[model samples]
Target chain A: MSQEKSLLNKLVFSLQCLPGVGRKSAQRMAYHLLDKDREGALRLANDLKSAMDEIGNCERCRDYTEASLCEICRNEKRNEQTLCVVESPADVAAIESTGSYTGKYFVLMGNLSPLDGIGPDEIGLNQLKTLVEQTDCQEIIVATSATVEGEATAHFISTIVQGVKDKQVSVSRLAQGVPIGGELEYLDSSTLALSLANRQSI
Target chain B: MSQEKSLLNKLVFSLQCLPGVGRKSAQRMAYHLLDKDREGALRLANDLKSAMDEIGNCERCRDYTEASLCEICRNEKRNEQTLCVVESPADVAAIESTGSYTGKYFVLMGNLSPLDGIGPDEIGLNQLKTLVEQTDCQEIIVATSATVEGEATAHFISTIVQGVKDKQVSVSRLAQGVPIGGELEYLDSSTLALSLANRQSI
Candidate 1:
C-alpha cells in the first residue's frame, strides 16, 4: 500500500517536469491518466522513453533528431545559402508551418542570458560561425524572439557571423512591428512605437 | 529519420491526452522534454508506465490503489460509521486536505449523467447501496459538485439510502453558498441568493 502511494506520488512529481505544469496540474494529469486514459498514458510513456533516449541534437543545426543531421539540414531542395537562426526547435516548427521559408535553420536551442550563465558559446554560436565559414551560406536571418535576451542573441550572432574572415554573408533580423490583426488600442506601447518608427509606405 | 520524426510526433500526440493540453501545448511539452529535461522525461515515462499499469480502483470505495482497499479504507482510525460519498478521487483528496473530515469515503468515480448514458449503475450506486447495507455506516455525506448532475445524484443517493429496510442511514450534502473570501459584487445571483436563503444567526 505504501509502495503504491509512493508510485502515485512519484508519477505526480515527475509530471511537474513538463513546462508550465505545477503540482496541482501534475496531480490532475496523473489522476486523469490513471482514471480515464490508461492506454494513452501507456503510449505516452513509451513515446517519451524512446524520444528522450534516442533523440539527439542535430550535428549541423542543433535541432532535435536521431540522425546526425536533421531532415531540414539533410534536404537538398532547401535553400542552403540562406540560414534562419532561432532559439529552439519549436521556433523551427513555427516557421516550417508557414510554408514560406525554403531556407535551412541554425537552432541556438536557447538565447543568451549571461546572468544565467548562457553565453554565446553556450548557445552554439561557435558552431554557427563554423557552419558559416565552412559552407556557402550567403545570408543569415536572425529570427530570435523580440525579448531582451532574444535581441541580444540576435546582435551577438550578427556580429560573430559578420566577423567570419573573408565571408560575404549578409545578416538581417525579422522585422519588429505591430502584428497582423492586432488592434491599435490593444497593442503594447513598445510594439506600437516600433510599428510607427519602422513604418513602410504602400 | 522518418522513424525518429514519427516517434517525436507520437510523443506530442500522446501528450495531448492530458487535460487542458492542446496541440500547441503538447508540442511545447514534447520539445521541452526532449530539449531541456531528458532525465526528468525518462523518470516521468517510467513513473507513468508503472502508475498506469499498477494502480487499480479500490474495491471498497472505488478510489485508486494497487491494493484491494485504499490507504484510507484500510486505516483503522477513521470513522467507518460515517462515509463521505464523493464524485471522484480528487474530491477525496480535496476533503482530506481540509483536515476536518475524519470519516471514510465512497468514491463514485463519476456523477449521474443520464444524457451521456451514465446512470446509477455506471457510477457504482449499486455498490454504494451494498456498502451501506453491509457496513455499520450511519451517515452518508454527499460531497459531489454543485452541478445539476451532482445534485440529482445526491438526491438519488439520499432516497436509496433512506429506502433501505431494517437499517437507518442519514444522508447529507455539502452546503451551497457564496464561497469564502468571495465578495458580494463579484458573486453570481444564484450563489448570493443561496447564501441569503441559508443565512445562519450570528
Candidate 2:
C-alpha cells in the first residue's frame, strides 16, 4: 500500500505540474501513460526536454524558431516593403496558412497593458519602432490583438513609427470581430485568411 | 522567435500527449506555461522523467509501486485472514478511497481476455491460488471486474481455490450497475464504496 501510494504520488506530482492541469486531470494522464502509450509518453517527455533546451525566439520579429531566424523571416519571397506585426507565432501561422499574404512581418511578441504593467518596453515596442524606421517598409500593419492592450500597443506603435521615420507608414488593424480575446490559433483558417486579406487602414 | 518556438514546442508537444488534448488545448497549455507557471513546466518535465525511471510494479500484487510489497500487503493492521482479489491497483484504490473494508488485497494486474491473448497464466491466477493455500487466510474474496473477462477470471479463481484448499474459501464479487463500461478509477468515491459494500456472493 505504501509502495503503491509512492508510485501514484510520483506520477501525480509530476502530472499536476502541467500548466492548467488539476489533480483529477493529472491522474487521468498518469493512468493513460500506464495503460495506453508508454512509448508515446516517453517521446513526449523527450520532446519537452529537448524543445525547452534547443528552441528560441527569432531576433528580428520575435517569432518562434529553431534557428536564428524563423522560417517566415528567412523566406526571401516575402515582401520586405510591407511588414505585418502580430502578437505570437500562432498569429504568424494563421496569416501564413492563407498563402495569400506575401508581405514580410515584424512580431511584437506581446501587447501593452498598463494594468498588468506590461509597457511598450516590456513587449519590445521600441524594437518594433526601430525596425520600422530602419527598413524601407512603406506600410507597417499593426496586427496586435483587438483587446484593450492590443489597441494600446497598436496606437503606441503607430505613434512611435510616425515620430521616428517622419514618414507615414500605412498602419492598419484587423477588421473588427475577427479576433476574440485569447488566441489567433483557434480562429478558422479561412477567417484568419480573410482577416489578413480585408485588412483596412487604421 | 526561435527561442520562443523551442520552449513553446516542448509545452505544446507535452500537452498534446495527454488524452483528449488537441492542438487547441496544447496551445492554451503552452501559453499558461509561459505566462503563469514557467517553473512548474520545468518541474513537470523533470518529474515525468523521474517517475518513468523509478516507478514499477509491486512484486506481490503487481500493482504500480516503488517497492516489493504493496502498502496493503505491508500494513500489519490489515486482516491477514481475509484476501480480496482485484484486477488492478486502480480497483484497489477505488476500494481503499472509501475507507471501507479492513481486508488485505491480491491484485491480478489484468483480466482474462482471450482476444488479447491474456490467459490465467498471464494474470498469475495460479500464483494467487498458491498464496491463498499457503497463507492463514480463512476467506478469499474474488473482487475482479464485472466484465465477461472479469467473470471468467472469477470462475477460474473459484475453481482453483476449491481444488487446492480443503477448507471452503469464501468467494464474493463487487455488485453490478457500476456503469458497465466504466473503469474503476473513474467511479465517484461514494458510488464505488456502495458497490463494494453491496457486493454479492459469486
Candidate 3:
C-alpha cells in the first residue's frame, strides 16, 4: 500500500544494528551477505546467536569470558603480584597480545559515568578491590583511558586501594600509553604500537 | 598474539565476509555503521536470518514464497499461462518491485556450475520442467544471467521445457529489463553506466 519499498528494502533497512556500522555500510553488508557469502552470511546470524547465548563478563575481573575466568585469568604463568587494570575486555585482549606484560589483568568493564548512572558497582569495582586484597598483588597499574571518566575511575580505585592496609600498595596509571581522551581500544590493530607505547613505572 | 583494535576492525572483518564486498568498502561500511546507525547493523543480521528462514522457492513456479505458492502464483489475477524463469529469488523480487509483471515465476536458485560441482538437479531444473508440463503455460520467459553458467543453464532449461509435446509453449526471454553479462542482485547496489538504457525489441 504505502511504498517505502518491498521487504528486501525493509530488510536492508536495519543495517545499523551491528556495532560500528552505518547506513551505506549496512546496505553494503546486507547486499554482500545476501548476494555472495550465503554460508558466511549465515555465520553472521550464528555469531549473533552465539554472542547472545555465550558471551558473558568474567565474574572475577569483568572481562568477556566463556567460563568463570578468561584465558588470561586462568593462565598460571602470569605474575599474581603485579596486576594491570583496564576499562574493557577488548583492552585486556589488546594488552595480552603484546606478550610483554606477563602480569595478570583486571578489567573494569566500564568507566565511571555518574551521568549515565554507571557507578563502581555496575562495573565490578568491588570485585577488583576484593581481587587486589585476596591476591598477593603489591602493585596495581591503573590503565584506564585518559578521559575524564577513566581518570576519575583510576583516581577512585587508587584512593580506595591505598587506604585498605598498612601494606602500602603501589598505585600508578599507564605512563602516556594513550593520547589525551583517546580510548586505548582505537589504537592501531597491530602488536607493534601497543607494546612500544607501553612504558615502564606506570 | 594479535592486537584487538576498535569495534571498527570487527565491523570491517564482519562486512568483508559478505559477498562482493571489498576491504576498502568494508572499512567505509564499518565507519558508517559506527558513526550513524547501529540498528541497521542488527537489522541486517536479522534480515539475513529471516530471509533464510521465510523465503523459499514456490513448489509450482520456483518463485520465492513464505508459503508453497508465492504472491504471484497465489494471485487469482496473475497470468497463469505465462511463466518467467530467473536464476535467483533476488531476480523475482526485482521484477515484482516494478509492479508491471503479472506473470508467474520460476527460480533456478543458482546457475549450472559443473566445475563447482553444481548441476541442474542441484539448482532445481527438473522441477521447473515438471511445472511447465503440468501448467497451461503458453509463454515461457528465460531470464537467466548471460554468464557462462547462466547461459548454459538457460540453454538446458529451454531445451527441456520446450521439448515437452502437445502444448505450444513459446519460450522467449527478457532482454528489456536487463543488461548483458549483468548480475541481477548487483544491479541496484553497484555503480551504473547512466543506465537508463531501454530494452531493444528482440
Model-by-model DockQ, in order: 0.60, 0.40, 0.19
Off by over 4 Å in 2: A1-4, A177-202, B1-15, B34-36, B176-202
Q: What is the interface RMSD of candidate 3, in Å?
A: 5.7
From the highest TM-score down, the ranking of the candidates is: 1, 2, 3
True contacts kept of each: 0.78, 0.45, 0.27
- Collision count of model 3: 21
What are the TM-scores, per candidate, against the unseen true structure? 0.91, 0.80, 0.63
Residue range with the least summed lDDT across 10 consecutive positions in model 2 chain A: A1-10
How accurate locally is residue B87 in candidate 1, as Cα lDDT from 0 to 100? Answer: 93
**DockQ-based ranking:** 1, 2, 3
* CAPRI rating of model 1: medium
TM-score of chain B of 2: 0.78
Q: Write the per-residue lDDT of candidate 1 for residues A20-116, one digit (tens) a residue.
A: 9999999999888888899999999999998988888899999888788888888899999999999898888889889899999999989999999
- Candidate 3, CAPRI quality class derived from DockQ: incorrect
Winning model by TM-score? 1
Which prediction has the highest DockQ against the true structure? 1
lDDT for each residue of candidate 2 in A110-171, tens digit (9 for 90 to 100): 67777878888878877777787787788888888767777788888888877774777787
Looking only at chain A, give the TM-score of model 2 against the true structure. 0.80
